[model samples]
Target: MIRIAGLGLVAVLLAACSGQTETGGTAQAVGAAGPTGTATVPGVPAATVAFEGGDQLSPKDPIVVRASGGTLQAVTVTNPQTGNAVKGALSPDKTTWTSNDRLRYGATYQAVATAVNPAGAASEQRGEVRTIKPSGVATASLFQPSSGDFGVGLVLGLKFDHDITDKATVEKSFKVTSSPAQDGGWYWVGKREVHYRPKEYWKAGSTVKLETTTFGMPIGGGVYGGQDVSATYKVHDSWIAKADGKTHQMKAFHNGQLVKTAPISMGKTVDTPPRGPTPTFNGTHTVLSKVDHTIMDSCSYGVCEGDPGYYKAPENWDVRISNDGEYLHENLKTVGVQGSDNVSNGCLNMNTENAKWFFDNFNAGDVVEVTNSGGPQLSINNGHGDWAISWSAWQAGSALRG
Candidate 1:
């Protein structure tokens, strides 16, 4: 006789039959083939399997799996080469399983899902996926004051397109070198931007170089995009002057040497402006920022006369003298009354050539002193030309302290 065993194939049969005489005693025929039959066994059912939609991911990302129409008995993920295993458990619905830990990058992983039905029939499903390595770190850009320009009063700025999770790794890849050593430091302006500046103005003749080796760095969460970049800049000769409205005369210096003397006109005591009790200038001031302009008679220092300071101007000769709106430029129309008479609006009227000569000679750090201007010395926050701040104060703003 044939018998079927539950869902899996297993065979068992009677060895033999004995033959005996008839009469009243009964015996089975040995070779009679009484009930020649074959045994049938059912095949194990296949378990339906699938992966969650987010299966494709970086090494630092998670993996999820789903199975259907069966009770999940065991779920495991393994690396075929190393036999390393990741343990996973079935969800309450018995159709889902997940691995919380992140997978290794650039690796292929296999998942074996085991399931059983109420009939105690066992089945298995297999799945495979490859985890990719994190993306390469992107390049950082040199920010502030574009290359190949003259009279750029800007800090050395660096900006990353992506947020930097690994600060040490990113920092290690950065380097700044100047021909003449500068007391400088990096300050984090934002997650993507950083600024570097010296405690004082750059040396008159210096070459600056910046480099970043950002490729392949794991910036954050295993996602990185950085490139190797380098830049070199030449520091030009320039002068930035500070003027106090309280001081009436302007002194010009070249490379720390007193060079020229020019009489200046300042805001009258009655109309003292408030840059700081007395108006002042700061940072590396430049000359001749622009030239030629129209003049508007407007209320200044709480005083606006219909015709008080109205003059159709020549080119706007900009000699950045103070943090406030003070300058030492040619005021040809008001030249006769500059020093002896504080007749004009708050500007030091100089001869045009003198103004041009001063502009041409002075670099970013050359000094111009203005007295009789009623204001405090320029503070740090005033302008890009904020050279007035003491060296100690400037050093305090560094991100990397040594």
Candidate 2:
């Protein structure tokens, strides 16, 4: 059954009965009790209209005709007010016919169908329909990450304001591709949200494309797409830095090749008062943006400036990767402890030289994966955390993933 989510509908299902049989058209003889209690034959033509006379309809509903006899000869759906025909297509076998374009709401339409028998005879039928008026229009809202330069795991995210009941019609309208053309799929992350990603991590210097014809598409009884949207993302160099707190090491990869292995200090495993564990989160992330220098305040983490937990410093070469305030930056006065121990506040602390090298080479969108950090994995809603979920699990979120 087709589900209707929060759609205001007029209660008139669109099917009408055509009495018995007709001449000249291929029909089956259905045995029936005659008026005089004798057996009689009822004619039911192979071709018939899908809508009932004077029935209230929806713009998203299919305007169809069923042909079971020989083949579909002709079908015409037109607005009586404008005298323009609604374009439609016939199935290969000619057994079914359907409208190809969207119908208009609050408008009256007339549908006429004809099918030929094997004997060259024709069967004709016609029906009138009136579409329902919608209470509100739902539009698609795109939530793409940073547009400039990005890491290899960036995804194009989209969210809608309303629930969708028609998955096939709506999903088919999307067209996501790449300049070099990489295979990818859209996963439903929520009832109103979708995320698009390639089968593997995107290659460096590749361009991703996103297009949607969902505008004006009927998604439910009364809901239609509000507008069309498109975007292109530029993938920069592959700069993936993997940090492990337990091993106290950070490995940087460039274009699938190992580039550098720097001894680093990560967050501590113990939790402090007012602030939770200083450990870094474990999972995939992306470099959202970078800063040359910033004032690092201990009070931001609920610690007083003069307290034992409070320590103020001007941080250097900061690269933010998550909304939880984790960063890959330089930690002055801690170069000796970096290689041998974990002793910082949820950051990958590097020496000045290594931090300067990292700051010069990396940009927004570079993948930064952390592991064994003694913290929870980054969530899908986190900064560029779309790659944290498994592919099979991610695909399950889509409405059309069946």
* Best model number under TM-score: 2
Off by over 4 Å in 2: 1-133, 145-147, 163-169, 272-276, 296-313
Whole-structure CA lDDT of model 2: 0.72
| Candidate 1 local lDDT, residue 222 | 67
TM-score of 1: 0.48
- What is the TM-score of each predicted model, taking all chains together? 0.48, 0.62
Q: Give the top-scoring candidate (lDDT).
A: 2
Per-candidate local distance difference test? 0.53, 0.72
In angstroms, how far off is 308's CA in candidate 1?
Answer: 11
lDDT of 1 by residue, 79-131 (tens): 78678887666688786787866456556777766554433433455567676
